[model samples]
Target: MDRDAEKIHHDDSISHSQREASSAASTTVFAADVGDRTTAEGPYPRLQDQKDDVPQQTSAPAPPSDTAPQRGKWQKAIIVVSLCAALFLAALDITIVTTALPTIAADLNSGAGYLWIGSAYLLTSAAFTPSWGKISDIWGRKPIVLLAAAIFFVGSTLAATSVNIAMLVAARAIQGVGGGGLVVLVNICISELVSMRDRGKYLGYVAIVWALASAIGPVLGGVFTARVSWRWCFYINLPITGVVFIVLYFMLHLDNPKTPMWDGLKAVDWLGTIAIVGGTLMLLLGLDLGGVSFSWSSATVVCLIVFGLFSAVLFVLVEWKFTKNPIMPLRIFKHISNSAALGVCFCHGYVFIAGSYYLPLYFQAVLGASPLLSGVYLLPYAVSFSVTSYATGLFIKKTGKYLPTVWFGISVMTLGFGLFIDLPSSPSWPRIVLYQLVAGFGVGQNLNSPLVALQAMVKPPDIATATATFFFTRVLSTSISVVIGGVIFQNEMERRYSYLRASLPEDVARGLTGSSAATSVGILAQLPDDQLQIARNAFYESIRVMWIMYVAFAALGMVISVFIGSHILTKEHTVAKTGLKQERPVAEPTEQERA
Candidate 1:
């Protein structure tokens, strides 16, 4: 063909591809156009045309240099905002239902005998997280994210209409699976599209989602339970999630069909996933039911103990040898920062969530606060997490790294957890709020730190695996904490209160007859005063040990942070198999050499 004819052909092909790009919108397309290359050699590396291995593929051969958007600028801020909301909904479900359980139990004609509602979701979410993360990596974040949204919405619909306790628990389990995906996968989306340098700046938006959801869930739940129905809390996720999913459909088409599946799926440690889940579930259940419904020495508890140990041993063995694509890359453990980050995660979970579960019990059972009041008193705590988290995002943006702030966050959380050690069962309102705020701030800071660290350390291709692994440890730790804390509280309360008739004053000791001593009061209540005081003193002592447990975990988390692999900003980069980040060198190594 003639020279002019050839030029025309090339132009036509390029235009066709650009049309394709516009039609498919979910990627964090740099908002700016891809301009001409100024350098004879080009500024960024030439992306290989090898269709299968790469993450970010050049859609229209980089627009003219002048037209190219700045490297850090991106197209999907609104999508992120919506996603943040979805994330909030998913996480909020975990805690919100706990507050509404008593109402549900009575309505369903089941005495408040089943405390398994929270566990059903927790276990299912934990079980499915690795699978969901891997699927998101394989299928791309958009499709799977949409799938999760659908699942959560359906689960909500199911729960809202349920007539039995069994159905409610089952519905929650379904939602938990979806919620698990949303929780673990959002990080992949955020890191993939946004520039690493700009991540911290944009990251605050995520912090807001976490904090606000916790704060809003209970209040909404209370209102729904009192006025509309307990079902509103579940129903609410439907419209909210449906709207986000529709918007996402129009805005995103991110599963780079061009990316080879092997890069993301090839190394997936399925055996590791199986082993981990089995071990984790067994262990969590053993801890959960051992001393509450069944005595620790009972045959049932013994069998559970045996099963848990066996599962753990099997899991470790499987992870150590069998799977071709190991889910939890043991190699990540070789990195000090990853290891330290996980350690911090363990302690962080212990300090924060331990308070989350028990404080409500204290409020409701001991203080006689209504569910709304409980959620309200806890408001400052949840809000602090959100406000500080968003502020931390801004801080990281302005300061350039999350390190200094992380240190401060850990220190504060540790102090906060320690404060609960002195809480008396019958505290004045101000004292309770003060302690709640302190613990909340500490817990809030922790929520984002390790996640940021993991993102900073890994490439986009490996982010799914890394993120799943990180959260796996995190959620797993939380499971263990909840189970263990429950056991401690149950056993201690039972042991302490078992002989209460003889030791206490006649009027004060009478309230120890049933479930009141074991539960939390989130909102302030209209209950009788005598019952409230008895429950309060019992809780004050019970929670003291739980806080003591928190102090230990927080200290452990801090120590882990000390050893975390703080990489000095480096000039190297790796492409995420999942298309989360562009193929570019990440942050410049920190100025300090030791990291």
Candidate 2:
């Protein structure tokens, strides 16, 4: 062909492909920034010509097409508020029940039952998170989110009415199935609604919900337990979810990729799903049970961990070779920036979550604060976290940069935890408040920035998968952190068992030692001043030892943050076609193409 003829043909192909890009069945074509080397090197590859192993990169996102209307300010606000509410309920359940654990245990005659109550929820929530993210792509985000909320509603109802510890445990597991989805789906929906550049500012709203939930969960749990009934903890979810369901049903509108039911079913990666869920369950179970229900060296723990690792390997292989549509796509991990951001997320989840759990313990054991008062003492952390998270989000939006926030957050977190290691047996209020503020400020910066980084790095087609994978990493890290922190604390307690046994009466000491000792934390309140002092000192020392683990994770995050590559924060709102419904059925392939 002549040069002009070839140019004409190329322009025709570009036009054809750009049209296909808007179809629900194909990826959206993101325009590259001026002078972007990736696109400048060659013509952009058409979807049919692209291979699974290759990932597309573009810094500038094209404006939304005529078909998908841009959301106005109020419309965006309503959608964001609804998502935040859903996230609030899910995060609330994670912490609220902690304050009521002792009451629940006593009422149900459950010894060491508090452990399973929390473990069951975390287990299911973490295990199912990635699945929710992937399936939302196939089924559309709206239906999946609604389904998740409904399941959570049922679980909360069952939990509220449960008469036995076994029933409560089962109920919480069900809630986790939904809670996991809510946590992931809300974030996914938010990503869809805004560009990476503006996402942080909106994510600040999410951070506020999280902070409120974290700050109030314990307080609310205490109030219900002391003033009414602990069951109210579950009851509170009913109203919030109801409002979320109603509001979202009316307001949350997005393109549905009207895939044929049969095709959608076929698109499901069954093998990958089973492998990931099973592996997550087994791994979490092993970690939760090891040293608590059974010795770390027990056959049960060993077998579960081994099988889980094997299954995780199988999951990777299935996604890589077997599945046409993987639940967790391997392409998201192809970039160094994504890998580094995920590493930072893992460390953030590890140190920050475990630190939050232990802080209340310190207040209760060392400071002689009740559960309610402990929650109050944690206000500095919660408030600082909220403030910094919001402020950082605004900063990211205004400046269109995330690396600096990530760097500062992780550094501050490491410094805060380092200070924690040297906390006196009886810390002054100002010292306690200031240290928590430092840590919380750091934690807040991380709340959304790493996710922002991950989203910015991947192509539009991979956004949901990338977001899901990112969350799965963080949630999994949190579960591991808790279990490992528990193991460390339990061992420290064991090392000092002789001291505790000698210092207190035999019966009192017996109740406060061994695996079940944590359930007896309330007993410290009844002890004489001298006995309380001794008990507090033991707890203070044991918990202080746990701070080393936090410091290590924070430092690791700081190091990882340094390696995270930068991506341009584009203003155009773009999303992968995975969730958008097609305007019409996809045309059947010709015989020649099929062959």
Candidate 3:
């Protein structure tokens, strides 16, 4: 009996042990399966894949709960048009206000404060640009763009209603914040939507928007100032921005970025932000004041310059070591091509923007044309820019070569700038028109090439950073160039006015001394014919000096373009639909594998 009881207990223990072993094996298998699934689908499959599974619906696609559907051709066209309009609005604001500045100053009795009207916008725009790029990377493109547009609209409203010069300047600063973001965000969105091979073509269309704005802004401003009110210049943005918001709200769709807002805010490099903003503001202030409001050797100017340099050094250090995410990533400069391309971009801005601002001045102040007619005269440059940009894009798309085009364009641009130096004191209208067309053609050819080449070289994830940095460098260069141009032009005018003092009455000399040195055509028109002719000759000589500077910058750009080495154009998209890895080479299967 005892032996039989022991056997029963052993049998029960064996059965329990078997059950425990089976449960352990099942748990191990289940965990392995979960790991495999996670590895295959990735972290954001739920967010990215939902777009593919979305059912066709009629009512504006339900706000894209997880992911947005791939935009069809019609949708893309609509979105592109909307983006073009948004970009046009921003670009238009830059030049449109220039023609209206005198009106604004006169109305508000701004005096020297009128300088801040344009400088404030440019300063804030350059300072805020990089941060906007970094922020868009964290928060997704759509939200940041929408927010920028809203801010711009509010600024325009405030600017239009501003009762004082101080208020108008402040409002322009607010507008700069939005305008800066709009420029960066538009490039990023296009990079995402179009493949690298096709991106140049689309970007070329965007170039058209810029060209048209450059050409039309002053004309439009003149029309409004002449016929209506200068306030209409600010108010004009209202309808255009409203249309952009409505269209983008409905038509623009992107994957809903899942990062929590609080997390994104924490990740921001606030220290770097402060350093860059302070640095840029100081630098711009120093440039704007030097030889204009203050002598170059003045204590105020010297202090600002020193502070700007020190802050810039601090910004570099912070970006290199301290920040997890940098506003302008140092890693991008790792590629020699990228660095060289950006250098070219900087030089291009110096030539392009300086030319844009000064050419109109020449027509109005030297050639004795009305403000409206001066803008019309710019059509040769503007039309050539638009046509050549589109054509170059097509050329690149077909041949998949941009390096040659870049080289040719920069060289031609240098030649064109040289041609400008030969314009006589009183040149014919056709001569001015022809020279402008030459410069515009050269500019258009390479305007979008650096951006295209940079996009092709880097992986997709860095597109926004790369784009913003390129634009930042360009905008900063433009701001500096404008200030430098202003300094040179002003100094020349002062020297000329001083030389002419012996030939004129004391009151006449004094009249052209302070505020009237940079007087508009309308104001200059009020002068006697003899005085007007003297003013024209002085301006003509000063503008020629400016053209010499343009020629030098353009020549430097040509030299830099030689180093932007050749790269193979890939047919595959840079950023994949999954948004995981950014750099992947196109893989073609071997013929033997087909077997």
Candidate 4:
């Protein structure tokens, strides 16, 4: 009887152990499935090797459970059209001044002030971009967007009536403040209005507006400066802003949080704000002024650059440890995928924006195309980019995949830049157009994917913050790239000055080798055929070096994008609701705060 009892007990024990193992297996499978549906088992398994270090103890603020309220098709169309109009005006302003810079300088009699007109706008725009995102999160998107439009209107009015360079530069600065907000807020609004899975489709519309503006801006600037007045460029915005305002006022309706005025005011990270804004302005000033207004090694340049770096570091420290309502939460970087996406964005901005700026110079100087013709030449690139951007978005929406597009885009971009290195001084139209089309198509594929991937990786509350940060990085990198491109081109020209000047008149050579080398392509038109040939060769070679740099950045972007793990973009949207009495979405307390 004892032996039989022992056997029964052992069997029961074995059965109990088997049950425990089965339960463990079920739990593991459940966890994996949850991850698969949300954040785990990404296409890039390599990134998963390093465990995500997002603080487990401190969770992000829970976003509103309310889904975005659906609207009729016409309502959605109105919202998109209004946002596109706003984007068009802002984008138009960015490039409209490029072709008119010479005339503006000549008219204002401020040769020294020309750079600041553009720089001021860029500085304020980039500096205040992240703030707009945070501010909109608190104050609501509608009010902030309206305020942005108002400021832009005022700035445009002031710019049109400016009697001096100082006034014009300050006006542009005001415009930048509004322009930055307009751009960031529009993006935030889109996030609220659409699911992450469907975002690319609408962003394609935004891309079209930008492309149209870019294609026409320079041509319009040239025509206005030549046939009418450069002031018309500023004047043009007034009507567009009016249209945007009217459309948004009547049709746009978004949820606003019911937080009191004083509470919202207190929630802002004032110190961090000062640090980032001040630092960005100083840094951009140093970059824009370097080699143009001052020697790169001069005291003003060195001090500005150094102080800017220090301030940036200070800003990071403040956000990490000091502010509960941090302007840019450091936790966003805790995810490897986010970091990798940022890297890709950085390179994209560096390569594409700088490429756009320099390509015009190449056409005007090397190929001897007129400013207007150069703008015309740019159409192929702009059109290809716009078309491809829209198509890629549709492709992603249909397939629910972004990594393949991202990888393929960067690969093609690398090849395009590589092809540019072989472009000759007397390249045929087919060669020029075909090369640009290749590069533009590649760039278009990437225009929306990185941002989509970034939004997919973060919590709903972090979406606006992440979007703002992404633009900030892109803007900052663009600033750096334009400066670096200028430096490389100028230095290359200087290196070749002795050889080129040997065949040219002293005055002509001086003008070509001076601060205006890249911009003063008009000088080439005045040169003798032999001197013009020399100048073209020099410009082509210098631009070739720039292409080499772009190729490197494109390759780096591809490599960086490799580690960006893909997440399934959620169809459900859970953005914050405004005008509702709800707790603000601030960073959750640390362990110490909890204690």
Number of clashing residue pairs in every model?
53, 5, 0, 5
- Local distance difference test, each candidate: 0.66, 0.81, 0.77, 0.81
Local distance difference test, candidate 4:
0.81
Residue lDDT tens for model 1, 445-551: 66776777766655344567777877777787777787677767665666666555555554344444333345423311433555445455666677677667778
**Candidate 3 residue-wise lDDT at 220:** 89
* Candidate 3 lDDT over residue span 147-209, tens digit each: 999999999999999999999999999998999889888888876777666777888998999
What's the distance in Å from true for residue 136, model 1?
Answer: 2.3
lDDT-best of 2 and 3: 2
Candidate 1 vs candidate 4, TM-score winner? 4
Q: In model 2, which regions exceed 4 Å deviation? A: 1-68, 102-115, 163-166, 226-228, 498-517, 523-531, 579-595
| Candidate achieving higher TM-score, 1 or 3 | 3
Q: Scored by Cα lDDT, where does model 3 land? A: 0.77
Indicate the residue-level lDDT of 187 in model 4: 80
Which of 2 and 4 is ahead in TM-score? 4
Please state the error at residue 56 of candidate 4 in Å: 19
Q: Model 4 has how many clashing residue pairs?
A: 5
Question: For candidate 2, lDDT tens digit of each residue in 314-409?
Answer: 999998899877888776665556788899999999998866788878888788787667777888888998999999999999998898899999
**Which residue pairs in candidate 2 have backbone atoms (N, alpha carbon, C) closer than 3 angstroms, thus clashing?**
256-580, 256-581, 257-580, 257-581, 258-581
